[model samples]
Target: MTANPLADDITQAAACLGGDGLLAGEVQGFAARPQQQEMAAAVEQALTDASTLIVEAGTGTGKTYAYLVPALLSGKKIIISTGTRHLQDQLFHRDLPTVRSALGVPLKAALLKGRANYLCHQRLHMTRSEGRLGDRRQANQLEQVFDWSGRTASGDIAELSNIPEDAFIWPRVTSTTENCLGSECDWFSDCHVMKARREAQDADLVVINHHLLCADMALKEEGFGELLPGAEAFIIDEAHQLPETASRFFGMALSSRQLLELAQDAINEYVGETGELDGLPDVARELEKATREFRLEMGQGEQRAPWSRLDGNPALTEAREALKTALADLAIQLEPLSERSRGLDNCYQRALRVQTLLAQTTEQPPADYIHWFETWRQSFRINLTPLDVSENFNSQRHALPDCWVFTSATLSVNDSFSHFAHKLGLEDATTLQLDSPFDYANNALFYVPKGMPEPSSPDYTRHMLDETEAIIEAARGRTFVLFTSYRAMNLARERLRDSCQFPLLVQGDAPRNELLERFRELGNAVLLGTSSFWEGVDVRGEALSCVIIDKLPFASPGDPVWQARIDAMKEGGGNPFMDEQLPHAVITLKQGVGRLIRDMNDRGVLVICDPRLLGKRYGRVFLNSLPDMGRTRDLDDVVKFFHASDALSL
Candidate 1:
């Protein structure tokens, strides 16, 4: 194939860095894969052509540099949106610096995270003075934070991983839009969030997470200015997650914990002790009691009842009213303290949201969305999300005439982009599918066990677990058994725990990256996980030689949102299973299968325990979606394939 002009430019750019001159300058001289070159071309073209572009560059593609290079070279203000905060930091701190240094480009780049990551000095001082440190544990955490703050130049909370993300101390230490005193605060001039924004405003490249990007798209903050002002282009990596993230930004949600936090914060302002709310623990106890009574009175016999049933309960009505009155009383008591403590502003705002949520839930909701209540051990949550995110995303895209680029490794089915394109409302957008340079034929085997029950069968989970155990034995424990449901994952974990000869690690055992680190360190550990593990996991060489998918990841029809979407599609003369569900499953399955081959010599076995793939008519669609692995039913062949390859080397 003739090299495109942008590709030629990238080639010359790589040549400037010396070495093999094939864009091989990786982070610390790690060789750049050929797929990275292809991705770089697509990104460069998207910039030059000024049109929407979608490309799927698989694992081991080194796609970070691919897009980063063109973005820096174009010298245009660009917003590079990532799926996670981890990647956002990596791109800004590590990848961007290396690429800019190697390519001899002196482009300024800034990393901006969501509002919650930055410390709110206004809230911090208020919390400290109000005696809101609560307990010795919190006080110690605060002391450590205070010491860290003095030394911290960036004021990014992520710098302190010792503190859990969900720590109660964070809400007290961090600033929110509602609670931020702005110029009134002593630290406003030195605010980390504002500093990051200022840097983003001046830089040619800005890195942000999807949530922040979507928030900017949906909320349109004025004082802080647009996130991508002066930006001519946008690149969203891990693009599959955009639809869900956009939906969350567009929708509304309220949880009991949020309400309680508000009540506690307000109470702290009034009582001058954070633990003073603890003295009123009876209030929480009463709330839980009333919630349970309300649920029982509502005829929600089972733990999981349709949200529609929430309105029928008179007890719920009474409970909600009682909660509202309590919150309002708390808010009234804190009104005077808001002047003294900026933290009280957040409490007041939260109370207002709770009151509003109660009102909205009582009223008839919009037909486009589904309202639901999720009951947990100690709390209840009310959620309202659009049944389909496509419409909202479509509206947003139409509103902006700016060029867009969405890329992921698994955006297509059998080389067709119709599913993802339709879902994202990009029907007319240009699309490309860059095949991974890894040779799957030599590197992997697709193992579909014979005579397994259909995925829908009652015994399917048990059978799948049994078969998975056998394969794990053969592979000698370098495995990732991915399940579609938590139920199956639990069952598999229970049944295989003692039987398996290797050390077993499940998803919940630790955070994903930590688990991966352990798994790689052990070298032959078996890790079992669900949806998150299906994609965005990079275990390139050893430590992962077998990937067993429980079944095709079809959205459960019984799921409230999925059911609503299916009905909506049916009304529009669309086959939800084919147009919506199948392609989604294809992309998901592609992600699971793509985990196997991360390098040219990397080898593994992809075993789909679900017989439906071979038995059902739609199976070919999923099969075709995968790379050309030598399909087989024999267990022995998979063992032979693994033994023959160098992937098993210690």
Candidate 2:
């Protein structure tokens, strides 16, 4: 009989995660979960077979260790991509070490982030010599970065905790693909991005985020040098976010910031190389002026509108034309001086690329693409996003011919993987859905208040706040009130300011991490937030005892991307609501609901304020997608749940 080495490998992985095995015995307070062990076995099978696998391990399934143990034990080259950089760091620094230690596996691991996260030594020196800062504060921050740059090894900006990530000085120091001088750079040998990529290539396991993964995929599609190393297996931890992240990367964008940066770089390079701003500064300034004027003509307030809205507006159209002409003039000027210096040459190439993208963006979009523009306070971005990213993503997946595992707590809508699989075009993938090991039936309560008005009514916010006040009083301020729109969140903040007794933390008041820290510390704070607060937020135990949602999280019809997809679906004789919109909302709502019951010992109440969950026919889909918990329409039951918790504490 032939010895099955792959089967033996999977058996060893399961044993390590089993009840009386390595993790259970060696790791402190580690309770072995059957679901987690099952997931590990499945992951091992996929790794050994080199096949595609989609698994939805519900909350508390220990999915991190589930996949990590197998990948570490498999001894194959692996790349694990997370949803955000924070998660990437957490897995690399926290979870991976724990699992490897328990399994006693000796493996090389590395963490690689996007280029923007790393400081560019070339750009930093240029910024210092240029001495162009907005204010004294920015100047001081630049010096702080300079001081730390010398002591740092990895060049990751997160190390300089004193400077906020959103500081204006960072952009002046970091390099983007458009501005980075690859081989011609004087600091190419000491480049942090290059060093990280090299380490990733050498390591047996690599940790990265979704944006970097998608960026590498995009670069590969364009026939550029790949940002990541070829791997035998790829594990996407937060698989739910990949489709959207891929959309952004697979698409093309022209932003006001890119144009403004080009203008500034041109002037800086010309002055540095020629020692005088003879004729280039004026042309560069024209480009800057035109970019700002075009932004102003777009609108007064921040908005996202389709490019078609510019059809009848002559002033906006003229501004856009003037902007394009300014870009053309600058490109013509830089063409003559392209050989002056590498900096000038790079700027010339960037100018031409931006010009091409601007023309393509403003022109009629190609098939399967949606042309739209979004504006902020002082900047705007014209984007061309594909209506469906599945085709591109599927092609990339098939091109690799490697093991791919997509796992998330919310991938399945109504206990089916069809929605998520269809989005990513996973044609032939094995699927697994493991319910959480948490005791949700006894510890959680799902509530939808009675006597609520339609979400479209003007009084809906008022009514929603009224119901939330009752739940807040019951839960004693341990609640999260998530809204679908910023308008609703702001209104709730204003109304609850005078009425609610608990400490209220609004989203925009501070950084998200700070807000979450305060919420966890206060133990009785009610956080009011919008879309960002719904997912990627984990607050276990009693700090977060309730989650209050304002409405069904349907993608806004006003959003250009969503509208385009809806139109395309309708044209194809598909039910846009059921086929496209509803699944998206169900997935989003599940994210919101996930914040409630994170662990087995956690007890909480979930209040979804939208009456549509019970009033409409499509409500059953949303209801069926959530965890099996006790349901109620009365406020007394919610209050009793909390009171019982108080009794236990006493």
Q: Please count the clashing residue pairs in each candidate, in the order shown.
A: 0, 0
Q: How close is candidate 1 to the true structure, as a TM-score?
A: 0.90
* Poorest stretch of ten by lDDT in candidate 2: 1-10
Clash list (residue pairs), candidate 2: none
- Structural similarity to truth (TM-score) of each candidate: 0.90, 0.97
Model 2 per-residue lDDT at 454: 97
Q: Give the per-residue lDDT of model 2 (tens digit) for 1-650.
A: 11112233446678888878888876788888888888899898889999888988888999999999999999998989999988988999999988888888889999888888898999999999998799999999999989988999999898887788789999999988878888889999999878887887788999988888887787732211443436888999989999999999999899999999999999999998888966999999999999999999988888898989874588988998999999999999999899988889999999999999988888777888999999999999999998888998888877774799999998988877888888999857888888889988999999999999999999999998888998999999999999999999999988999999999999999999999999999999999999999999999889999999999999999998999999999899999998879999999998988899887789999999899999999999999998899999989999999999878767
lDDT tens digits by residue: candidate 1, 112-195: 887789876666776777675668989988877777878887889999888777787998888766556566667889888788
For all predictions, the C-alpha RMSD in Å is 3.9, 2.9
Best prediction by TM-score: 2
